[model samples]
Target: MSERETWASRAGFILAAVGSAVGLGNIWQFPFKTAQFGGASFLIVYLVAALGIGLPAILAEFIIGRKANLNTIDAFEKLGHKNWRIVGALGLFTGFWILSYYSVVGGWVLRYLGGSVTGAYFGAPAEYFGQISAGMDALVLHAVFMALVVGIVAAGIEDGIEKATKLMVPSIVVILGALAVFAFTLPGASAGYAYFLSPDFDALAANFTDIVPFAVGQAFFSLSIGMGAMITYASYIDGDQSLFGDGITIVFLNSFVGVLAGLVVLPLLFAQGIDPNTSGAGAVFISVAGAFGSLPAGQLIGVVFFGVVLIAALSSAISLLEVVVSWVIDNYDVSRPQVAVTLGGIIFLLGVPSAIDTAWLGWFDTLAYKFFLPVGVLGILIFVAWVYGAPAIDELMKGSGLGDGVGITWLWLARTLVIVAVVVTLALGLQTLFLGANPAIIPPL
Candidate 1:
């Protein structure tokens, strides 16, 4: 066996992790969710859930990965709890499941990027979206998008994934910041800001049940929690880096990007007289495309906006693909390139149904968000809090600049509040799934 690859630098690892967290979950889904829920009310709940539950859960996975220095499933077994490998398996499966449909959306971003260049979608934004959203065009674009992901993963971590994200993440931030500045100058921008920033305590209190689940789901999804991507990334750490510090940084950057996305998306929609409250999976593409079409310098702005989204999509896709690829290379004798191509092809084929028809995509996404993600999160919390026990804290404390006191607090929180919160969220998600409840309340992350 050969030595495992490590991140080229701390900055590289941080960028890759942030790239994974700040994908379509932020740019595409966050805006619509804010519109569908009570805007700032939803934002407030999401921030709480992210810090309260998402951060600790992320540290748990980081501990498991860095301690074992192996792939997700092997990490557990290497830690002397072979039975707990099931949790890692769930995470691996969830990542794979998500990417299948997720690549389909990535395809849409790529198509829109090109359409923006030619002003193709500007004439009739909705019709254009309808034409390209499914059928052969979508399937072909899905393959193209997956190919880009495979090529990068095959190049090895430091040279490919790290290098790509170092550029992509920064570009996402700079472009988004500029777009937000532009959005603020629009005439009706105040209404969008009001919708996103102004809180309605009454609605939040009354619709707590309906709102909280989606907020929790958004936190998990946006942070790339409950997927094995973070675990896989952590396995590449070369030293006793501060896992706590890194986790905090990732959460803050990810949350900032999500909020920044809202700043650009909502204002643009309101400026063009498009309803920001439009719901469903197509909300971002259809509504935002219409807004871009009607704006001055619309085509140029559309090109830049969709280009940023395409970069975000690819960055996240690389992490999801890496989770599966890392596991295979750890266990099998195959080379990284071979594994990437074979698995990428299989994933592409799996996504075909979704590419052909978006209803299938919705089903795949719903299953992942509602069932798979929460279960993966719950399993990791149990393992870290119970099975790994005290040593989990010991691993988290290396170079973390903290004493035993903080570690114990994190452990107990994981054992009690985090676990219970996950259980409640999972129960609510399951109820919505099985009882044919209103899905708009628990939109797919």
Candidate 2:
């Protein structure tokens, strides 16, 4: 058997991890979610859930991966009960399911990027989106996006993921910061700032029950936990690194980027006299595009904005693809390149319906978000708090400079607070899916 790969450097691992966390959700979804749920008040609760529940859950996954030093399924199987492997399997499938639809969206971003350069969508953004959103062009773009991801993964870990992320992550930050700076220069920018920063205590109190679930889900989704991506990334780290510090850094960077994106998007929308409330899945091609088209420099700004999104999407897509590819290579005798091609092809095929049919795209998205994500996260919490038991603490404490007390407290929280939060996420997800009320209030396209 071949020797397992390791990250080239701590910075490389951190960048890769951060890249995985910051995706399309951060750019459009997070800001929209915060605005919908009372802005600053929602932000507070989200921070709590992210630090308390999301961070610890990521630590748990890191522990399992680093301690066992194996692929997702093998890590759980080796460290916990035999059946615990099923958790990894579920996570792998969830990642796969998400990436299938996610890639289709990535393709949409790519198309918009092209249209921005050509000024094709500038005339009638809605009609332009309708034309390209479905049919053969969308599928070809999806294939192109998948090809980028597959090519990167096939190059081996350190040489591909690490190198690509080291470049992509920093670029995303600079571009987003530039956009935000430009956004602030717009007239009426203060209104966007007020909407995002001002707290509404009464609104928060009244909507706590309804808002908490979505907050929890956002935290989970933002961190790329509940799926095998974090576990797979952690598996590549060397023993000397601090998972706790790295985990915190990842969360902080991801959160900062999400908020920064809001600063860019919200102000741009407000300046154009558009209601951000109407922005959903098509926030870029619709809301932001509407604003850009009216600007003298719309074509240039469009390139920068969509380019940042494309990089962010690709970074996250690579991690999701890696989870499945790692599993295949771990269980089979095939080479990494071969597995990347096969699995990439399969994922592309799975996403075909999404590219061709808007309803099918929505359904795939709903299924993954509602069921796969929450359930898979819940399973990880159970495995860490129960099956792994004392060893989980040992894994978390390594190089963390922390004592057993902190570790024990984390375990207790995971077994209690985190579990409760995840349960709420799962329940609300189900209710929204079947009841059609969507109390969790997810964003639309």
Candidate 3:
């Protein structure tokens, strides 16, 4: 057997994967999606999809990754067929596309982190975002954010990247938690919580067809499914621990972070008399900035809040970078530094359009969640459900503390409901992106 690298600690592996799973998807996309759908109605669907849809896909990826003990590319090849290798390669491709767009946004978070301190967005959230979100400013910030990720990768996985995630993940949780507590003390916080928790079920039922697909896509993309991020992260697992259990923990943490973010953000918005349910990707930025401007200690809290968001985003971006980095290291046996530089150069060039064109940001985000993500996840489900078949279940269940007899239950879902549902959802979701409800705008990185 070839020597394989594993995480030095289980906590490190779990945190790294969780960090990947929790990101702007949670802090940025989740709330906008919830508002757009049925508010409370959408939230219910999101939770179910996270458990039913997201968890199974995660376990499938972990099984393939751990069983083959290879990065996405080599993992599928080791599965025996030349055809299987493409499955892994597809994952890497999605991962690459995701980073091209995602890093650009991570840069926005980097800029906002400093802005929060400098009171750059103090009185005019709209104007501040308008000035900073697109054009040359966005491009520069994207470059800075990409550089941070590339630098960590260049320094090697253990010393530079993983260690940073271990710290960043905890800070994310602590800061988000603190922010939430602070929010509760705000004047209208209780109202904010009510608005978040209470759903307009009638509205949801009416819009269920259109809304369901988005919720499913949210569950899939928010958890980083089908991008090979989980598969890549699982490649580092050594303990014959129940992948089911670990997967559950990671998913729970990811979902909790999203809810926690809503808790912190919505209450503050409500207290500042901003509606919690607003439209557009810019809604939170607009609302949050206003809240920061009004509060007595808004600047300090804004710094901490945006800081947590930045940490969350950066940690997740590391996971995306690692996916490409690990694949290069595995296939070419190239030094980590070379892999980082090579991939970083490619991503930097690719991300230019995303940073410069704000419309491309929405398009890419839609394309990833609505089209590429579900399509890729369906492929993974097919491989595990039919190609790998019963053996995959046995292997996945072994020594997993998380799911015991649940193995049979999960395999059944993967074979039957999981793929079928994802395919249908992907179709409708893509339709919505290309045909319905999309606005033409320059993408803001």
Candidate 4:
């Protein structure tokens, strides 16, 4: 077999990881979820869940990847726990399942970007979204988006995934930051800020059960924790970099983007008196499109905003594609380009149902996020804290500039709090799914 490829630098690895984390989940879904759940109350719980549960899960994946220096499934076998490969396989499957519908959403973002250029959606934002959100237009756009992702992954690690993300991640940050500043300048922006930044404890207390599951799910989704994206990316590391430091950096940057997205999206919505909570699946597209249409030079702003989303979507898509591509090339004697195209074609075909009907897309997304993600995360934590045992801690502390003490604390936390929290969240998610108790928390299509 050919030698394993490694990241060109520490920065490349971190940026690529961040690029995976900072996707449409953070920007597209977050604001709408916050609006629907409890505004800032949901945001507060999400932050707590992100740090408490999401961070340690990220470390667990990092340890697995850096130690094995192999694909996610092989990492388990390499570490002498062949049966535990099931955990990695679950993660790999989750990423694949997610990308099937995720590509459809990416296509919607691309359509909006073009519509912005021609002022197409400006006339009737909701109608425009209705027209293009699914069917043949969406299918074609999904093909285009998948093609871009395939080309990037086909280029291999250093040249394709890493190089593309370095540009995409930074562009996401810069453009979103500028948009956030502009969003704040709009009329009635203060209400959006208050809704986003000020938590309603009473509301949070009342909706504690309803809110926490979604918060935990959002944290996992936004941080790319449950999927093997982080694990695959970490496997490419060439040095004994601080996994904790890198994890922290990835979380911080990703959270920053999530918050910035809320700032830009909510303010834009409120400034135009659009109610985001009722906007359903097309919340971002419809509400933000209306907001832009009503604003001076709104078309230009729409172009730039959707452009950032397109880049973010591609960055995440490439990482998900790489999770599968990495596995194929590792096990078989196939070339990267061949695996990329073949897998990309298959994934595109898988997404066709979602492209043809958004209800199918919602079902795919809900299944992955509500069931697959938490299960994948729980499996990894159990493997790391129990199966891998002490070596997991040692892997974390390798170049982390920390001693054994920190590693032990993290391990115990993973064993107790993280695992328990995930279990509770998973139970709640399952209850919601089976009982249909609270359908609102089910992600919008």
Candidate 5:
């Protein structure tokens, strides 16, 4: 067995986990997805999924990873039946798929970061976005992003990963906080709030089946669940930490960031006199960029917004890279440099179509989010709920302030509500992705 090294401190572990959670999903995808789904109603469902389903499941994975002190496959072998080991491997595979497309998106954000500084889209935002949103140019940016990700992972986990996340994640939080506050004070801010918060419970109830799966997918996305990123990152953790406490905190912060993003994007879009809904899933990027471009100090704020996203993205990408890197080094005894090249090369090839084509990019995004991720998370929830049972109680109880009492209650939740929610969400995600959004069945928007 290799020697285990914990997070150098508790703050380091908390920040890293939160860093993973607060990526493109929360900061980039959440606002846009919410706007598409009827604003605050989507947020309400997302909250329920996060606390009821996401937190408990995350705690379960962290327990297994930390207790076993290894990557997901070995972690399962330590906790449950020999058959269970493949569950973690599936998670690892999902993480690779996620990073492949994720780097493509991250590269776009990096390009926008540079674009923001130069007022690249100042006059005609839509045309500029159309030009770079896909094609060979996007693929080149994707390669650059992939190379940067490969370089970070090549430097090893503790030193390269931790140091960068430590510096970057906090800046993301701070800038987002300030931006949210600033947006809130803009004229017509109440309209933005109303756009986001004034829920049509009828729309929600009518679209419950439709929305619930998205919420669950969003839950997986926001909490960084299912992909073995959590499990792999937790494997590096020392024994002194509380999985439940950290799990709750990471979920809280990530959800908050998502909400904050809605606040920042909605009000600013309304204030800029652009239809907030027009940008669709690309709303946050375009609306915010357009908003910044119109402001008194527009260029500076544009730089800040885009720069912050770039930092947040890289922090998340590093974790995805680590999961693949760990699998290679642990299973094959591969050198760090070679593993980086091997895994990076495979992802680069798999992601090329996504980088070069908008349709392929959308396909990867929808398939991974609405299909791959939920299925991956569903497997985790089921495995934890039934397979591990008593051992899960013991693992959760470890370093838990409440011990068996808290563990037993959560175990019951894990068995009942968590499993049901994940299954339902996974089913919904599959339906939506394959069948398309049947508005007649969903609701008359």
Candidate 6:
């Protein structure tokens, strides 16, 4: 086999990693959850979870990938015990599972973007969403989105993934920033700002227990933890750049973009005097898009917003496809382009049911977000805490530049605190999924 590929530059790797994290979760889901769970309160808990649990978990994956200098499955096989390879395999599966439905949503974003330009859904957002969500149109759109993803991955890492992210990430930020400024200029925009920035202390106090799990789950999902994206991305690190700093940078960028997204969404909704208590699926389609129909230059604004979604969605989809492709190249003799086409084809086929059936799409989203993701996270935590043992600490200290004492601090937290929290989150997720009880607590996207 040829030599393993490495990132062309540290900035490219960071941008690609940040792009993976700042996806639909940041733009579509985070704002909804914040609107649902007392905005500032959810923000506070989410920040804690991101820095406390999410960052450590991300660093652990980085340690594993860089220390072993291998792809996901072999990274585990090479670094830890034999059976631990399943953790990596599970991550690969999680990436495949998520991208299946994720591409469907990407297709939806494209449809919405086109609709914005043509005023197709201008006066009838709900009907348009329902009509396009299924049938042959949805299938065709899904395939088109998957092809875009495959085309990027097939070009190889430096030329493809890194270059694409370098463009997309900056564009996403600039567009969202401009939209937020424009959104605030709308009448009654202060109400939205107040709703997002001001905390409901009493509501937060009452719902503290229920909110923690959602916050942690969102953090995990936003950072692309528990899945192989970080592990696979980290394996391409070319030099002794600090993983600790890069991990922190990635987390901060993800959280900032999520907050920036909220600034755009909440203001737009409040400007139309729409109640923010709608279901997540309807928040963007019914509330935001419906509001857009009534405003001046709404079509132009809608085009920009949905365009942002398209860029964000494609950025994330590339990472998901790369995860599976990286593993194939590591273990098999297949070329990158062939693997991209083959796996992308299967993933596109898998998404057909989701495109045809809304219920299937919902179920897949729940299954991956609630069950598979947390389980994958738990496996990594276990591997880092117990199996990897002393070598894990050694790996952490190298790039971190933190002494043994700080490494132990991280180790103990991961072994005890994070593990217990993940277990509880997993159990609550299962409970909510099986019983129809906890509808208020949203899972991470």
Query: Which candidate ranks first by lDDT, i.e. highest?
Result: 1
Cand. 2 Cα-lDDT: 0.85
How does each model score on TM-score?
0.97, 0.95, 0.95, 0.98, 0.94, 0.95
Count of residue pairs whose backbone atoms collide, per candidate: 0, 2, 9, 0, 0, 0
User: Model 6 over residues 1-445: C-alpha lDDT tens digits?
Assistant: 5577888999999999999999987897788878777888888888888888888889888888888888778898787477899999999898898899889888888899999998888878889888998778889999999999999999999999999999999999999999999998999999999988888889889987557666777888788987799999999997778887888899999999999999999988999988876654436766778878988898998999999989998888999999999988987888999999999999999898888876677677767767888898899989988778778787777756777897888889999998888898888777767675545244323
Expressed as tens digits, the lDDT of each residue in 142-200 for candidate 2 is 99999999999999999999999999999999999999999999998888888777878
Query: Which scores greater on TM-score, model 1 or model 6?
Result: 1
Q: Model 5: which ten-residue window has the lowest total lDDT? A: 436-445
Scored by lDDT, model 4 comes in at 0.90
Following a full C-alpha superposition, what root-mean-square deviation does model 4 have from the true structure? 1.8
What is the per-residue lDDT of model 3 for residues 252-320, given as tens digits with 9 covering 90 to 100? 999999888878877787788887667666778778888898988888988887787788777777788
The C-alpha lDDT values of all candidates are 0.91, 0.85, 0.82, 0.90, 0.79, 0.86
- Mind giving the per-residue lDDT tens digits that candidate 5 earns over 10-30? 788888888888888887888
* Candidate that beats the other on TM-score, 2 or 4, i.e. the better one: 4
Q: How many residue-pair clashes does candidate 3 contain?
A: 9
- Where does candidate 5 clash, by residue pair? none
Model 6 residue pairs with clashes: none
Provide the clash count, candidate 1.
0
Estimate, for each residue in 316-383, the C-alpha lDDT of model 4 and write its tens digit. 88989999999988899989999999999999999999899887887777777678999999999999
Error of 4 at 351 (Å): 0.7
- The local lDDT score (0 to 100) that residue 349 gets in candidate 3 is 84
Cα lDDT of model 1 by residue, 1-445, tens digit: 5569999999999999999999999998789888888889999999998999999999998999899999988999999999998899999989898899899999999999999989999889889989999999999999999999999999999999999999999999999999999999999999889989999999999877767778888888888888899999999999999999999999999999999999999988888888877766788899999998888899999999999999999899999999999999899888999999999999999999989988888788777777889899999999999878999989999998999899999999999999999999888777777775555333343
